[model samples]
Target: MIERWLPAAASAHACALDAVLFGIHWHMLLIFTAWLALLVVILIKFRQGANPEPRPTEARRLWPAIAIGCVVIGDAVILTTLALPAWSARIAPPPANVTPIEVRVTGEQFAWNIHYPGPDRVFGRIDNSLISASNPVGIDRDDAAARDDIGLLNILTLPVGRTIVIQLASRDVVHSFTLHEMRVKQDAMPGMTTRTWFTPTRTGDWEIACSQLCGLGHYRMRGELHVVTAAGWDQWMKDEQVRLTR
Candidate 1:
């Protein structure tokens, strides 16, 4: 039922996070039912209609303590067993023997700057002084490695069935890079770089939203996330390279 309303899970980590969420909801429901049952029992046993006179002294019962303990135990179980495992699985180092696609994402007032290292797989130097309307990422095009660098605004294209490692940062203020379908949300802060990795399990196009309220234009801050098949990705890369070299 919970999965029905959520966006399609397009990444490996999405299912793991969903499992944790489902467990938490079930635990909450059980606790609510237990408390409601206890309330009903108390009302029936101690009501004035049932007992004409009430005693000043009350008998100590173990059930209340047990119920509280159970709640505590349930929380601990969820934190250690379900939540931690899912978090670790997503944050773990890239899988062995897998070549991950890496990209740099920088968030500004109302846009996401997409930087892709060309075939060299090495990003070029970024000079803060070179930042302008046309050059969002401040790439030094004269550099050999930067000659093939691809910079796009509000568009990120990735390949399916592969690990994606993102070096996230902010250009001005704090912003959350949110990918709903991919189960990815991370803060991109200024002057600091944060690394996040995930493996895409399906192919689809989704909206990348800025979950954080950065400025007045936050509502209009949106980007496109495209996960395509291997062949499609290869062709896209080839076209981009040809266009750049031409």
Candidate 2:
């Protein structure tokens, strides 16, 4: 319901997002209602003709102290009950049995570089000057990891149950990597790497878009993420391998 009304700007950190939002929203609604009613009552009860004399100044002074107290205490509870747990879940330790798949994600002037670790589970060094469709990862080819890596742009996919660790970096300015259904979004910054992880429970096609405005072609800097069933993902990988070799 929150997603439909507020619609997450992108995928949220995890399931914890909704809980935190629920708690904060409930408190906010109560506060707003109380404040609104107080304002309405004051307007009606304090008309100039209705009262010959004003209330003592000391009585009004106490209102600010009371209101601030409520606000401060309310916020503390929200942070303790709502925000902290959600943040923890976002950066919590991965379980021991979880198999992590590594992918190097690089953002450039107007495109994305997705490098899949080859059979050796590594990505080869890239040569900028030799970039071409056939050499997507910019792999030296002689390098074992580059030789078998399935590299491409515009389209990417992941297996439904596998946990994916994305090493995000930017070659130019900043850009955001977001996947809506899985609720994972992170920034890609130049000279520093940011990491994001997510395990997709639902399988479907999703959008990979840049949330930040980078340049004239920012809108065009978009792609698709296809989450599939385990068997379907395996088939896609096999197809990619064949495509890379040919």
Candidate 3:
């Protein structure tokens, strides 16, 4: 219910993440109401016409202090029950029984470089010197492994129902790779690779944005995320193969 106004939850783990969001909002609402009620009671009991003098310290009620303690405990409970477990699962490896599709995503100043391993499932060598306006991912075409690798700028396509593992890095400064529909966000730092994985449960198109302010053009740093059905994925693979053979 908390996510109805937000983007479509297109990933398998999206619902779980939404549950955490719901819990937090409801918790805050209860907190606000409790504090407001307490304030009203204090105002009525200590009104100017009734008694202008302040109450003695020993006569003070413990209920107010107890209420504050309860709020703190509730927050800790929420962290243990919802946030921490979801985070642990997010960092967990893909199922060992199934082979996950792997992609290397490099974040530049104003764009995302998507590199796919193609049929071989092995990423090719990348050279920083080869990076340019045309070759954002810096794929070494001379390398046999790189010959079949498919690279694109600001476009990510994945087959629905498959687990995807993405290794992320930055070409320059720090950038955040964010997919709102998938409820996935991770920072890409230069010289160090970060990893994240997700399973697409629905077929649709979504926008990928850089959640961090990296530079002057940060507002325009965006990408396209596409999830396709099985037949559509087959057709895409065939088209890519035909284009690669040429």
Candidate 4:
């Protein structure tokens, strides 16, 4: 039943995340069932007709303490056994031998700004003072590093089976960068840069949603993420480089 509600896992790390979520939901279900059963028992046993006169409660404080203790233990076990380990693995640095595809995502009022460091693999300088409607990210064209930079609006393309690191920021307010298929979500905050990484295990298109409410147009802030083959990625990069130069 839990699996039915979950989005399809498209990233290497998504299965682990889904497992954690499944465990949490199952735990919550069990707790809810136990509470509901107890409520029914208490209501039936303590009905007005069952006890003609008010009596001192026989319920001991020990039971409540034990229940609270059980809940605490359950939470501790889930955190230490499932959540902590998964989080540790997620935040661990990528292997030195693997070169991840890096992209910069900047959130605005109603759009996502996707920036790729062209063939050089070096991000160019961005000047806020030079920001304009046309130059949203303020890439200084005079800088050599900026010459081949590719700036895109609302489209993120990456290669399957390769790790992708996205440096996230916001131009206006806080926005959460969410890719449901990838099981990745991070807050893009103004004046601060955050990062999240994932390895695409499938080749397809997915929605990139702003999970946080930032402004009046927050509901419309959306983008697309396309995962393609390595060969396709190479061809796309070449085409983008050519387009940038032109």
Q: How do the residues 1-246 of candidate 2 rate in per-residue lDDT, one tens digit apiece?
A: 565764343233555676677778888998899899988988888877887888776356677788879988988988987798778778875567977888888887678888888657877767776678766557677766577777778677888778888899998999998776666778999999999887776777877888889999999998888878889977888887888778
**Order of candidate numbers by TM-score, starting with the best:** 3, 1, 4, 2
Per residue, candidate 4 scores C-alpha lDDT tens digits across 1-246 of 777788889999898888788888888888899889989988998888998887766575477788778878888888998899899988887668889989999999999998888889999987878777666677888899987777888889999999889999998889999999999999999999988998999999989999998889988999999999999999999998787667
Whole-model lDDT values for every prediction? 0.90, 0.78, 0.89, 0.88
On TM-score, who's better, 3 or 4?
3
What range of 10 consecutive residues in model 3 has the weakest lDDT sum? 52-61
Count clashing pairs, candidate 1: 0
> Please, what is the TM-score per model?
0.93, 0.89, 0.94, 0.89
lDDT for residue 238 in candidate 2, whole number 0-100: 83
lDDT for model 4, please: 0.88
The digit string of per-residue lDDT tens for model 3 on 32-111 reads 99989878987887788887676678358698789989999989988999988888888889889988999999998899
Top candidate on lDDT is 1
- Give model 2 RMSD, 1 decimal: 2.6
Which parts of model 4 have CA positions greater than 4 angstroms off?
54-57, 61-65, 128-136
